[model samples]
Target: MDRNAKFIAALKRLQGVAPIQVWPATVKSIQGTNCTVDILNTDLIDVDEVNLRADDEATEGVLIVPRVGSLVYVGAVENAVDNLFVCQVSEVDRVEVKIGNSLVTIDKDQVKAVRDKCELTLSDKATLKQDQTTIELSSGKVKINNSATSLKSVLDDLTSLLQNFTVTCAAPGSPSAPFPATITQVTQLSTKINQLLS
Candidate 1:
């Protein structure tokens, strides 16, 4: 089987929720007919909760899929476990993809998808780097791991994927806004008292 074909078969064999939500990502390696991608899905919030979790080869694993006419790549990084590339799937085999109306065949040149459920771990700090596979496809958004901030988020990128939100009160002696007591008579009295101290 070809690199694209093997990955496509992997994709087609996939079933259940085990398929990691795959978005296009950097390519890693392509030996023989098997192509690889360094994929990440930002929509997948619980990296720790969801993984292939498959101990046996016969068990189900996550799969990666790209829309038809999409381009994908894998493995070309220097000394890196995975690199990157860009290949447009020229001929799409038929298969049913949950995201779209069409399903791809198990083998074809444009087989821009993979079937693999992965378990990714994190460090003491929030940052994480894990290895996963996918076929070459472009979504105007791509990440090696979607657990953190990427280009897709334009609005300050709010979420655990990139940040952990924290709220703190101002310290004592911190500056305070001057009160315009004229809006209310009670406020005016308080302002007068504060002014006396000034």
Candidate 2:
């Protein structure tokens, strides 16, 4: 073929393999994993059924659903107008993240988590506050309701006082001391408390 005809043939071959394109858009609606968006700053117009971004293979990673009327960045693969997908969003209505058996969900109202166990480890301290009440954990100590007393310490003091309990006998007919049954019950109570709190 002539040089000019060969050049034209090459251009035709590259026409369908163009670079990806990204456009700013406004979300119009959402259904399942797809949404329609109005492409901004150009005459490109609205695109329908564009895929939303999924963090993982669409089934096991983060999923963010943008609110309607929110701004987003939509990407088109190979510059194809019909192969568009959401790449980034400005505002989200909900977000969900799942990895293995753990899952976390966040929405406008609340955040929820599901897992076998959860643990928070801190270097110095941690506190949970609500209005005037507070629970603080620091230096291997726990303070509840802004008080210095701990449940285990209170139980220990009570057990110690009961174990050493005594009574004054002002009259000869009065009982010499507490009943033997009372002492036995106190010992059993102490044992149970230790088992529960240990």
Task: Give all TM-scores, in the order shown.
Answer: 0.15, 0.50
Candidate 2, residues 1-198: lDDT per residue as tens digits? 999999999878876677667889999998777888999998766678788763224567777889999999999888878789899999999887778877777787656665555423233566554334455688888865423334555567677767777665769997676667667667766665554344
Residue-level lDDT of model 1, residues 1-198, one tens digit each, is 899999987876763323333344433333323344444453422112111112213223323333333344322223233222233332333222222322223333333222334222222222222333221223543333232323223233323212533334367777644233322444434444343222
In terms of TM-score, the best-performing candidate is 2
Mark the regions of model 1 whose C-alpha exceeds 4 Å error after superposition.
1-19, 40-198
RMSD of each: 23.0, 10.1
lDDT of 1: 0.33
User: Between which residue pairs do clashes occur in model 2?
Assistant: none
Give the alpha-carbon lDDT of every model. Answer: 0.33, 0.73
Please count the clashing residue pairs in each candidate, in the order shown: 38, 0
